[model samples]
Target chain A: MLTLHNYFRSSTSTRLRAALNLKGLDYDYKAYALLKKETQTPDFLARSPAGLVPVLELDDGTALSQSLAIIEYLEEEYPDPPLLPADARGRARVRALAYMIACEVHPLNNLRVLQYLATQFDQDDQGKAAWFNHWVHQTFRPLEALLADSPETGRYCHGDTPGLADCCLYAQIWNNRRFKVDSSPYPTIERIFAALDELEPFRKAAPPEQPDAT
Target chain B: MLTLHNYFRSSTSTRLRAALNLKGLDYDYKAYALLKKETQTPDFLARSPAGLVPVLELDDGTALSQSLAIIEYLEEEYPDPPLLPADARGRARVRALAYMIACEVHPLNNLRVLQYLATQFDQDDQGKAAWFNHWVHQTFRPLEALLADSPETGRYCHGDTPGLADCCLYAQIWNNRRFKVDSSPYPTIERIFAALDELEPFRKAAPPEQPDAT
Candidate 1:
């Protein structure tokens, strides 16, 4: 069986969990609390050199990290209930949408980045909130424009089916709500997210529904 | 024909250019100088909602953004002189290595981010350099560990061939050198970079070789 090493509230982990559920693949879950620095432990570091959570260990002892890479692997290996689109251009659009959130927005607001800003730069709670919200807006504005203007956008970020982009969008929207980011500016995202929330896979993979959620 | 709208010094642009060259594909180069904030203009923003380079505009007018996604699209569409390994797990390893540099390190040291540190946090040049080098070390340490330990590592990040991981590694190492980051720490990365440097495709794709380089 596949084993997933992840934290309940981690956005990347949530995305991977939803992808796995959507693919109907069962996996063992291993939880690590980021607040406690569990990922930095020597043993965990042995499994993942990056010391990040949401590592998927294969049955043959190979471990995979990075949520996007892991998802791509799953898409290639499983190839059912596909997370990516069939055509190359459609796949590029989906991947670009996913990267807009994962690489651009999420990286800036990651827990480690926030801590660095606080301890190194002396940012107060309000300052931290502003920093978080600033990136959210910067990314969401373009994202909103893309979704609103693109003819390819149907029930999801791509066509009618929910795929890789939706997984990332759902996870990011959840984080946006947690950080109290105003969603009023992004009606397209809010509408698509609302649709995704009703799905069994997405509902089952939500942070609050996780076994280790606080 | 393909048209790439990219800044010469942008690492992501460099990587994509190398990928295109490796596939023996020719393209029209539209240079945008990042230091001049060319990416923020209205026309560019219409094509790329993210307002970033390198935007790969296809013949049919489908503009693709984000270097990784664009590269993936090329890999799928072109397929010859493949930038990915044959097996699924091998592709995952290469992608993870690439993302480790792209998503983790490059985002932290991006031009806009460095500008934010200077303006918002009152960071001086020294402080900014420290911030940049800190992330470089943080990422390279684990990266060095991963590359040195894995037997799959050949002349490149994977077996014998320079693929997606090498493209990212080459770009990042160039940035490291530009910022005077000490390369003594990552012998494996240095070694692979040296090998890549000797290749015509990589050499042709260097930032200095771009039409916009001043």
Candidate 2:
């Protein structure tokens, strides 16, 4: 059996959950409360040395961390309803798009980062909001430019089907809304995100729909 | 012919260069002076919408952005000297290790982020160094634990052979030294890094050896 250790509201967790749903795979959900520091517990740390969420544990107890890595593992092992393109260049483009968000945007503005900003810099709520919005805009502008101009963009970030990039885009858009980031500047992203929201897998895997949602 | 548009000192660029050397592929180097904002030019931006360095341009005019994505593309195109392990679980483990540094550590402490801290938050030199060192340590500790404890770890991060994880780890360690991060705590990382430094591909890819290095 596949079991996932994740938190409902964490963007990384949501990405993994959406991927699982899209792959039609069933997993046991072992949720953590990030706000309560549940991921830092000794047992959780043993399972995930990074003390981050969305770890996938196999039937034999081997665990995988990093949402993108887990999703790629699923792609390699499952190979149906493909999340990546078959062509090499196309696959590169999709992975680049996903990393543009995953590596560039989300890491800088996630919960732990925001907490560090608050504690170390004495950033007030308004300051935190500004920081979040600033990075969202910085990353979104390039993303908008990429999606708006590229012919590869269809109903989703890459094609008509929702894939890895779509999963990341949808999760990021959801997080953007939480911080009240202005989506008016990114019509392409807004459109793709809208399309992703209609998909059953995305809807079912949303943060609010999770069993651990508050 | 392969052409790489990259800045010498950029960690991402160094990672790509090392990967290319590891695969025994030759490329034309189009050096960029990042301090002069060469990456922001219209032509460069046209190729890499993110306006980031280390874009690998193929002979067909296709430009691949994101260092990891480019490396994956190379791995797919050139199977010999495989950067990823053969098994799905092992590949996932390697990718997770790479992402732990790429996504968690490097993103938080890169040039643009440091500039943001300095300008927006009015962080002094000491403050920026503190921020850089803090994140390096924050990431390195768990990494050390994972590498030191994992049975999979050999002479390098995964096996005796250098692969994707080692490329990232070597690049990050080089950057860590720039900020004067104390490496004494991570003997495993230090030992692996020392091993990597002795390899020809890694040595050839060091920042100071590049044409653009100051």
Q: What is the interface RMSD of each candidate, in Å?
A: 0.7, 0.7
- For residues B21-53, what per-residue lDDT tens digits would candidate 1 score against the true structure? 999899999999888889999999999988999
Model 2 Cα shift for residue B110 (angstroms): 0.8
| CAPRI category for model 2 | high
Residue-wise lDDT of candidate 1 within A83-177, one digit each (tens)? Answer: 98888889999999999998889888889989999999999888888889989998899999999999999999999999999999999888888
Candidate 1 clashing pairs, residues 3+ apart or interchain:
none
Per-residue lDDT of B53-133 in model 2, one digit per residue for the tens?
Answer: 799999999989999999999999998999999899899999999999999999999998899899888899898999999
Over 4 Å off in model 1, which ranges? Answer: none
Q: In model 2, what are the clashing residue pairs, if there are any? A: none
Residue-level lDDT of model 2, residues A1-214, one tens digit each, is 8999998899999998999999999999999999999999999999988899889999999989999999999999988989999999999999999998899999998998899899999898898899899888888899999999999999899979889998888888889889999999999999998888999999988999999998
Q: What DockQ was computed for model 2?
A: 0.90
* TM-score for chain A in each prediction: 0.98, 0.98
